[model samples]
Target: MDKAYRFEGTYLQWLKEELTGWDRFPWALFGFGVGFQLAILLLNPINWIAVVSFIGIFFGMWCTVAMGAGGYDSEGNRVSSHAINGLLGSISVIAYVIINVSAGHYWSVLDQLVFLFLIDLPLLKNWRTWSGKSTEIKGLTKMGWLYVIVAILAAWFVLYYVGIYLHDTNPLWDALALAIGGTASWLCFRQYSTTYTLWLISDFVNVLLWFTALKDGYSQAALPMLAMTLFYTATAIVGKINWRPNKVQ
Candidate 1:
């Protein structure tokens, strides 16, 4: 068996292995997007803008992670992951606008979870398995570590944002959390120790958020978020148990 490369200064190698096999990655954006739309449909808030924005950003990140795993075109050229990410990002903007128009409440905890684990987690797990290739992903890079810190801070900040700012109902902080979370998630995929551990920590944070949301009487918004959180937890478990070096050629 090939030795698993230690997680030290190996981002370049990981990037290479990750960039290959672009043509056949199964991205799970469609599922998450669908879930978000349904959440909005069911939550049925008089003001739907905030909820839609939240869902849109969440799913957009979903697109970022799924696409980051890789893709290719008919001619076999590498399809730009950036392009896919950009397109999804644009959709998120439109969703944000819709949220402003709807002026609905933020997504509930359970709703976030459903979108995450149910819709997004499987895609990530499948990507890891299907890729079957593991390269050394170091977590020490300045940007990499920044992502980790930012992800945690983002989660924490959103909670505080919800609690402290009674009038600023824009949900911008939560959007920032999702954005940072998505970036951090991709960075996590590039490494090992930080990858699994950070995800577990993030899952815990989500659970905490669920409690907070529920206690505050936002139970209607908690379902999808909680679902996604659980899915993320499951992904962390699978990753830790099954992760190995060079499983894919």
Candidate 2:
């Protein structure tokens, strides 16, 4: 009886340790962010979704910073997997704003700018670390710089739309912004093998939808974007499961 009891206790302890590292907070935050962004996409009568998006974005960014600060794999590869993941997801929302704006449906440029400043500006302070020797601290490198450029273009795309919507200006800025952002996102896909690359691939698809919004309308692009996001969610799940840190012997 004593031997059986000891074996059961050992198994429980092992189970607890094994499950402890399965961080889910980042995923939850990202999921909510995506949902908020997608829900705001409208065509019948354009309305402000920024209020809800603001909440989602805040929580999402919080999760990213928290996870990046401590989430490491068994290999000691500090990729800030969760934080990067949230960043990727959040960028998609920013992408959508750009596309809509470019298509001439500007709503809240100030809000968008504030959101970007809050979530991304602090990251610039850590730029030097990307070149450092530490594997955990230096994951961004050139690829990270490219990612930042893409993010900027995306934000600019939104502002460009604001100009068009408010001032009735026909801007050639959309083409330029999309070209640069797409190229950077493509580079990210080429360089990384982790979930980060997959996120970029997903963003590439969103870029296509953005173009369609420019040509056809936001509704046309938005419906398809929603469907694609479902795939994005699935990909995130697959990545989370397969990329679990390989256990150390």
Candidate 3:
């Protein structure tokens, strides 16, 4: 296998080998995301808060495309794709925490904490498999299922209270978002096609989450949040179609 790096030839090789054959969907979506978010930031204003929000949104869009590109199918494949998903998701999470703290969306931070392990642990374990360095995944599916249950429970029981403790009235939505997001991320990590279906649900909740922020007068952060909402919708829908079960592979 070619060594993976950002240097001239190596970067191109990794792209061709690991991220090719998914059609031009990821490229187009990535272009749209960067252009749209940059336009939003440029046309409006420039401040530290705005910069952080844009950064968060950029990574958010990246994660969306990565998840779609690395989508899992119901036919017990795509775990390789899911590896990329978790890698990108981890970056998105860190950027998102910055966005949340900067925008005073503390509740979202708590939710991220709850799901952190779900993303990172899988990324570490699955990267080798995706890179063709290993082929052993004994009990991975069963362990993933356990994570699903534990994640949702943690999202609902623990993160739910965090929202309440923060005096947020929308704790229910927060909890549900975490539950869905956590499970959806897990499914992607496990290379399950149903992950996209779950992401659609989470995407809707994410829209609501930002809508709440916009409604609460965090306008500086709202516009980009709304833009991300639309991008995520497209990603989730396309992801489902791109790697569906029984589809021609």
Candidate 4:
């Protein structure tokens, strides 16, 4: 077979495997996200933008849960869920940015835009590998570690600067969440199981961030986001367990 045909076949096969097996679906996580959104909607004034944001967050939750359940393949590489996660997460960030901007929450818009870039970077950087055109799975090298450090530092500095200069509600929480979360994304792209640990840390910070926002009346739409971050924390634990490396005989 020609290289193009071979690549197509492999990609199709991977998709087939990923899409089938309904029993493997993370129904509990999905249900929690849906139920939480609905419950919050009942309590809050119906804002169309908030509804759209909820939808985006739901998809993002789906991606996270799916990645946790799918885990890695036999060769110690992540399943194709990483690519799908990136796509869904990008959509989620766009929704967040739209809502924040419409509400004149420029700080949140900045934060979401940075997150969108982080989520999409891997897809752009490793299209061939993620698309199954290449089966190469990268190990965390010195360069990868360096990348993570740089990302964290950059995220912190930017968020801190904005928080101090622009009077953001909670710059420290934003900076910590994104710094760790961005590192997690980088580790995830490299298929490192340790990504879940960083995710756990990030999610906790996010939960606190949103909780503070809701309590302080920074945003009336913070309830759903707070709930979403709580679920994210749960999924991080699940991902950590599911992504555990198999023991050597």
Judged by TM-score, which candidate is best? Answer: 4
Question: Worst 10-residue stretch by lDDT in candidate 2?
Answer: 129-138
Decoy 4 TM-score against native: 0.73
Give me the runs in candidate 2 sitting further than 4 Å from their true place.
1-47, 59-71, 83-170, 192-249
| Candidate with more favorable, higher TM-score: 1 or 4 | 4
Of candidate 1, the 10-residue stretch with the lowest lDDT total is 1-10
- Compose the digit string of candidate 1's lDDT tens values, residues 107-175: 322223433543245434333233223343333556757766766566656654663464433344343
User: For candidate 4, lDDT tens digit of each residue in 63-165?
Assistant: 6776666544433544424455555667777777775555444555665665567656565444335432112323455676687768778878887787667
CA lDDT of each prediction against the hidden true structure: 0.45, 0.40, 0.64, 0.64
Task: Output the better candidate (1/4) by lDDT.
Answer: 4
Q: Looking at model 3, which ten-residue stretch has the lowest summed lDDT?
A: 131-140
Candidate 4 local Cα displacement, residue 220, angstroms: 1.7
Tens digit per residue, CA lDDT, model 3, 5-66? 12234433544444544446677888988899999999987998788778777766776676
Q: Which candidate do you rate higher for TM-score, 2 or 4?
A: 4
Checking candidate 2 for backbone clashes, the offending pairs are 101-161
Shift of residue 138 alpha carbon in model 4, Å: 7.6
2 against 4, candidate with superior lDDT: 4
As a whole number from 0 to 100, the lDDT of residue 79 in candidate 1 is 28
